[model samples]
Target chain A: MKFSPLLDELIRELQVLPGIGPKSAQRMAFFLLERERPRGQRLAKVLDRAMSEIGHCQHCRTFTEQDLCEICANPKRAAVRQLCVVETPADLAALEQTHLYSGRYFVLMGHLSPLDGIGPAELGLDRLAQRLDEEQLEELILATNPTIEGEATAFYIANLARERGVKVTRIAHGVPVGGELELVDGTTLSHSLSGRRPLE
Target chain B: MKFSPLLDELIRELQVLPGIGPKSAQRMAFFLLERERPRGQRLAKVLDRAMSEIGHCQHCRTFTEQDLCEICANPKRAAVRQLCVVETPADLAALEQTHLYSGRYFVLMGHLSPLDGIGPAELGLDRLAQRLDEEQLEELILATNPTIEGEATAFYIANLARERGVKVTRIAHGVPVGGELELVDGTTLSHSLSGRRPLE
Candidate 1:
């Protein structure tokens, strides 16, 4: 009457992923069964390994299989004497793609939101403090999101860095390079105006 | 420098599914890593089983683990003497949900598209012929899509059924129920007018 038991089960399990609805789930299930079985099997193998093996990087707290992530394991990166803090590993990857920062990184995994019971402890502030003490960092960059909780998290981390005599800087806020000035939000425009730098 | 090796592999493998791009794949990987580990592990298990075990039902050609699908295995359905043929399992499910038809089904899995080299053998027309002879089906209903290829497929199957002295019918092409007449496509509106039934 319905899809075979295993097929039905596969469709239901697929809905556990965000943004997958019933129709999309069915399509994905059928697609895998009809044509992409080998790829789907590989996805399963990779997913199993990643879910079981991947854990936080010991030094930077980003998702990794090893005790220390690649960036954290690099002596040259640590010798740069600066640390960039971000809300998620995705943010870290985005910044890394720019190749502008040679310093190390600390990924929060999530921003501070007390209502959801995510605070300094959950953000691994203690580990960050320990790193600051041992690494003797010169500067700390706050590259968390521009939202309220992100700002609050940045402010808290900034205070921690200041107490350790480490200079703290937040990424600049402005109209994005490819964006229209007239289309920019009022608050961002005001921040851009106040934080403006004159040409040499 | 990049996501940890396993995490990177997981993200890449996730993109093997249709409609998942790099960003969405990353999000799905992170989502599974961050909070849905158990569900992710279960998905891996189910996906493995479904990909390895599920195959086309021997009788109906729908995806199923069993040799014959539930409808095809049912004696009462066989005795109904009516057989509805559809393009896919999803289409069969749609008709089943309506509770309008009381018969077994044959799933083509795809329509006739010789330009893509999908010929009679590929559509399992030979198996369909075998079913017509063996099942003693009174009427064969073609529920394929109202597309050029679907029509061609229906016409071919209708010829097959006529050769075996079995009655053949094609589901009507018309303006859809619960749709506005003005917004209906010209082809569908014209078909609806030409295929109009007398109100009793």
Candidate 2:
């Protein structure tokens, strides 16, 4: 059963979002049309504004309205020579939430997926190399996810930074905080044991 | 931790959607800004078009660009005097998917909820009464949900229709198809038992 043309178009458009399928799109469409028209209008306006105004930060490639992202623009963040590289903006945000990382970030936007035609260029490795050459960075922290693509991307970036005479380090992988040893997967448990540190 | 102004505003706008919390909103905002910029722009355009063009159908109060909704505008549907009243456009869409009901529909848009300040007027009871008086409706099928609020709204409409000399009936409440009897809730089990019919 097909919906009205406009409603059908709206549903199709909604499916472009990650993880939203046809069923979810239909539900969202009905929801927008039925009860939350004003909210839908607001969403439309914000989406338009964000798309037109927000672009990749000139320094770190993170989303920003200005030429440089907020973090990149801030002088305090620039004082630190350590640069954290992440697979996406969400990853950067997650690291920022911890408030432990006082340095700047470089968002790769995506990992190297050869099957999907995503390579070093797609992940902006050349631009990153240029940034490393320009900035007097002491440490390069690879904070990509634990996935295969993330590991590959991290390895590629680590090699590039080491060749440029910069100290490169990968974020440690292990059982997460508050995670029970027995509940953690074997791979993670092994990494935790291998990377264990002595109490100061 | 605060996001960039544009990202923060986009996340807040995304939270207006039902079922989207702060975390989900942030994820959606990043997804739109990072890779799916064109899709986000298309969504914005579609939303704007839908909001501005679509309005309540003059006849059934369902969403439509025309004066009457597709179902009400159809000549074949107009021949049927059976009127199925649903609480929202989503409910009407669900019934239409079954392809069993060939009658017209009157969407209430919401149920009677005094706590939320949604009452008879908010549900457009006056317009429904007018429709009932104007049309030669044979059966007024109250297909509102079986929730407490839905039941109250259905009863109110049923009373008004009966007063206007129309045969009013409520949709049957029973165990859903393929539902296990043991797993069924007590209220649903009782309703199914009370509404039991002899096998033909």
Candidate 3:
């Protein structure tokens, strides 16, 4: 209450983001104002630039500041033969961190959940199909999360990809590192046990 | 890794804010890109505009987009005989929230911590003295936090104000509402007990 209008505006704007409550927003507003005025300015500039300039890549639906994102622009990106499908840009970042996936990425941005009113069109399935038709992809890896919605979306996309004669794969999932037997839920432990394979 | 340049830029800018670690920065980055792009843009715009346009109010030392902030610009506020001194604009907000302080404010935006090389000049105590001379303040309330640095800063300013024949008073220190005695640490409990008064 009765905060500087600039602080008020910044806090209000910050509150619009996910998980940032009023108190945290106010703390952030004060901290930013105290430490670096330019930092706040730069954030605002980036936001303005991003909102005004960035758009979805024509091919992969990933956000881009230019006509195509750097991934799509790279000639050596293995875009022609291999592709990794993910639910959002965050997943893409996670995959990229491994430095193992040299293939191109297709970000769905959301999963298909009819209950949430998200469908094939909303998840960009038609765009993926178009990309599949245009590119000579040998394989399509469904690297979505292991959640129910992620599974349903992966299955739907895999079915569509299979119809077009492309190979489909799902990432393996089970108990995570440092997981405890007593604490692990039944379904997940069962899945871990069932999905076990020879170590050799 | 392998994030778009724009994404990388936004994340870098976000990291400049205090207490925002890399993980929270990443979450904020994705949240901005996905759910609140428009709001993010607006926030960014305000940040940019405020940063580029705002400066300290000549009279109070608080940030303002113009020569004086709205509070400092108001005739009613300037007409008040009491002056509240605070460590930062946030402290001013806390007092303003109570709607109990009808006086004007003078924000220090810092505290005197000589160990960290901060002193009277760094905290703009000289400027505050000048403001006190300019305005015929009936009372000057020291609203700094009750930390060691805050206490030192308060006494230093209080002494200075007394030398100039201006009345100076520090805000109270006491146990907060809903606070339990067992939960409170020793030093705080001592301060609260010493500062306690007889019931009216």
Candidate 4:
């Protein structure tokens, strides 16, 4: 029939993760059971510690062990008034890997999806508004993805910032770096053409 | 450049799982941290419970919460003296899903891979041999996979059973059910032709 009760429960719990379906959940459960028991124990410890200790950074809303994230807590980054707004901590981490941005970040943690009951409140727009009011932010960069939901989220945030006398800018939508024009989507190609910059 | 210490540790730990590479590990770690903390906490609890409570069935070497697995402990299945040997618990589960084999199972947990230091001791072949002696088995079915390691393991077990005066049989290797013959590999096609049965 089905797996044992404990194993069934493990598989069920594992499916709570994003992108893990029934098959993947079963594979993961078997993997945990078959491997050295210590590995599963270590995973448990890490999950417990992360759940208990990790929380939203007070300033930027990114995942952090303390009240403020490492980026927010750094004194050197405070003078950089520009704030980059992203949809998730993963996006923030991706941008951090580039080593280009010196300013702070505000993580929405999700994009706007009214159909799925995800709106301003769900995306923590109030907290974002508070951050805008408190900080001397010069230019607000909307670094959310270029999908429909991301566009809606960026537009909403742009309006919010512009109303408060802040300059809001969206990340350029165009053919990706090293991408061929023939391979790029029509919408992206159009955006790239319209937003093309003059070569200095 | 990298995730914070706790997050980094989580990514590394996730990578220990089978099929989980660096990218998947990072995705899982971020997913855990980003989701509701309770979900992660629940996964931790399940992992701990399964790891601590689940152990090998003394008789079959499959995962079980009790001393013997359900298949091994059931008195109804005791009369079925045919033992199907498999390389892993996953294989045993797959066979069980077929509902064709009422016989009991013996899980080697791994195949013979001398290059990887996996041998008889690692697969608990001594226990298998002891079971062969204790049980009045009619037939020993080698259900290990069709890979090189699986073939070697089957051959080794076949010799062990033949020496003990037990009937030994290997599962057929051919074109799978619902498979197109044109797409079937050459080796499989050859095996299918050689193993052709009479239409009685």
TM-score of chain A of each: 0.98, 0.91, 0.89, 0.90
lDDT of 4 by residue, B84-198 (tens): 9999888888898889999999999999999989999999999999989999999999999999899999999999999999999999999999999999999999999999999
Which window of ten consecutive residues has the lowest lDDT sum in model 4 chain A?
Answer: A1-10
Q: Show where candidate 3 strays beyond 4 Å.
A: A74-80, A134-136, B73-80
> Model 1's CAPRI class?
high
Query: How high is the lDDT of residue B34 in model 1?
Result: 93
Model 1: residues with Cα > 4 Å off, grouped in runs: none
**lDDT for position B185 in model 2:** 98
Categorize the docking of model 3. medium
Clashing pairs in 3: A44-B44
Interface RMSD against the true structure, candidate 3? 2.1
* Candidate 1 lDDT, A53-156, residue by residue in tens: 99999989999999999998988997898999999999999999999999999999898999999989999999999988888888899999999999999999
Residue lDDT tens for model 3, A1-200:
35567767777877876677888877877676667777777787877787677777877888777777778788889545888999987788888888888889899988998988999999788889988887888999999998999999999999989989999998877788898788988888888898899999
lDDT of the structure predicted as candidate 4:
0.88
Q: Encode model 4's per-residue lDDT on A110-199: one tens digit a residue.
A: 899989899999888998998888888899999999998899899999999988899999888899999999999899999999999999
Each model's lDDT:
0.92, 0.89, 0.82, 0.88
DockQ of 2: 0.65
> Per-residue lDDT tens digits of candidate 2, residues B8-104?
8889988776677898888888887777888899999998889778888888888777787788889999899999999888789889989999989
The worst-scoring run of ten residues by lDDT in candidate 3 chain A lies at A1-10
Ranking of models by lDDT: 1, 2, 4, 3
Better of 2 and 4 by DockQ: 4
| Residue lDDT tens for model 2, A70-123 | 899999999999999998888888899899999999999999999999999988
Predicted model with the maximum DockQ: 1
Model 2: colliding residue pairs:
none
